[model samples]
Target: MSGGVDSAVAAARAVEAGHEVVGVHLALSRMPGTLRTGSRGCCTIEDSMDARRAAAKLGIPFYVWDFSERFRADVVDDFVAEYAAGRTPNPCMRCNERIKFAALLDKALALGFDAVVTGHYAEVRQGPDGVELHRAAAWAKDQSYVLGVLTAEQLAHSWFPLGATPSKAEVRAEAEARGLSVAAKPDSHDICFIPDGDTRGWLASRVGAEEGAILDRSGERIGTHPGAAAFTVGQRKGLNIGYPSPDGRPRFVLEVRPKTNEVVVGPKEALAISELAGARFSWAGAAPADAASGFDCEVQVRAHADPVPATARLEDGELVIRVEEPIEGVAPGQTAVVYVGTRVVGQCTIDRTVSAVPASR
Candidate 1:
């Protein structure tokens, strides 16, 4: 449990279902602060106490597992490496994929647990073919995108007690009705590691500032930036370009060339992407027979992003996606989650993109 209302109520629901649930809170940071930052981010000492209290109220055994070492090595290091390589990564997805499902689940199974339960707002159902992952009933709070990295084996041993909830408000109310103290706690926002939420500042501290030239689409130097790692595709603000566009329109970041230490900016139209290729593909359940050929599916690039109509196929050990309508700001290292209707079919970490501009591809 994360010491939040969602997890508290989820534990309650699990208890009510007659399962002997033991609450285990992950200590993700070795040096967590004693005070809460009022931002509701995880790994606080207060959160650990709150989780203990919830477990006490539920009358279940509780323990804090120290996974800080593995988390830092996998999620934190991967985040830094992705940014240094000029790719935008979703660390939450990485956490779910590496820490929660892989490491934690393996530990739990070794301890004779049949499954690992969490408070995630996603569904796992047994279909005729096999297990399938689906979006939560609460569309706004659905977290199927982050859970897309789960393979078929992981999904078989996962449970989400709050997946069928109508809304987050209902979950909070359930927590209140159950006498849980965290009913009104705010939802966690921003990256947990960067408490101040200054990603650029945090990155600069680790990667250091490498002064570089900011170029336009035609490779003409327009300005200078502290580093290419600070910029991301589709970014508009903080360009600091001295002059206005020739067409008197605003410009956006089109690319970040880390090898060249170049930040490429251009009109928003230059950010349009029609195709994407990704590596490290994993299917949530059984791979579809037509996966080798092209199959129609909805592709989601970011968490909470709208799924776009697309054709997906596995070619030469890579997942290639061709969207019916061009998507903007697709960056490498972001996950490309594929779905057929509401069920999560597969996902892959994006490696590259094909822009609308033929020359750029």
Candidate 2:
């Protein structure tokens, strides 16, 4: 529990369900923690104290385990490198993949705990076939998309006590009815590592500024950008360029060229993509037989984005997804999570893309 209303309510529900429960607050940083009043970032000192208070209220043994080094290396460093490699990265998914499931789960198992529980609003059910991941009862807060990277082993040992709950409002009401002190606390939504939500500035500071030239489709210098790390594939604002296209058309980022220290921009259509490839593949409950074995699935290339119809196949132990409905501005270094109904089938880190071309071209 993070000392927040949702987690507090989750713990309470677990207790009500007559299961043995333990509360763990991850001490992800040695630096001062974040504010419950400030932007919705996690791991602040006040937040930790809040969590401890909630755990105390529940009469459960709560402990804070430090995972600073692991978080920095797995989530932070990976975020920087992904941007430097000209791909947009989702740090939340990275944390969920490496920290929550891998690091924290490993620790829980080593300590003899049968399972670990979190406040994520997603559901798990045991059907005739087997355990399955499902969309939370709350569609608005559904997090199964980000969690699609979990292996079947991890899913089996994990519990999302708040998964079936419908909303933050409902959770808060439960907390209040139960008289938990954290009933009024808000949710944390920003990337925990980039506290201020200024991802470009944070990334530039960590990776060092490398000024770059902005180019058009033909590789002609169109403008200058502050740094290659400061931009993403679909960004339209903050270009800071004064020139207009010869056709007097608006522009959008076409690509980031880290090797050449360049930002590529052009007409909006330049951003459309049809196919994506990913590595570091993780499947929920099954494995693909071969490259020819295709499964109909919904693929999410970005968090909170609408699911796009896609078909996935295995190639060299990687997932290659062909989006049936072409998606615009798909970014590499982000996760491509595949789902069959509510169950997460698999996920991978996008490595390459194929764009849509105009028929006239």
Q: Give per-model TM-scores.
A: 0.97, 0.94
**lDDT of each residue in 1-361, candidate 2, tens digit only:** 7767777888888888888788888877776543223527777777778888888888888888898899989988888888888888888888888999999999899989888788888887885556678889888989898888787789899899878777878888888888888887767777776666777788778877766798887878878888988888888998878978888988888788898899888888767888888877887765544435888888888778888898999877668999887898888787888887877778888888887865232
* Clash pairs for candidate 1: none
Give candidate 2 regions above 4 Å deviation: 33-39, 127-129, 288-291, 358-361
> Residue 112 deviation, candidate 2, in Å?
0.7
lDDT of each: 0.89, 0.81
Error of 2 at 254 (Å): 1.7
Candidate 1 residue-pair clash tally: 0
lDDT of 1 by residue, 48-127 (tens): 88889999999999999988889889998899999999999998999999999999999999999988888899999997
Give the worst 10-residue stretch by lDDT in candidate 2: 30-39
RMSD of every candidate to native, in Å, equals 1.6, 2.1
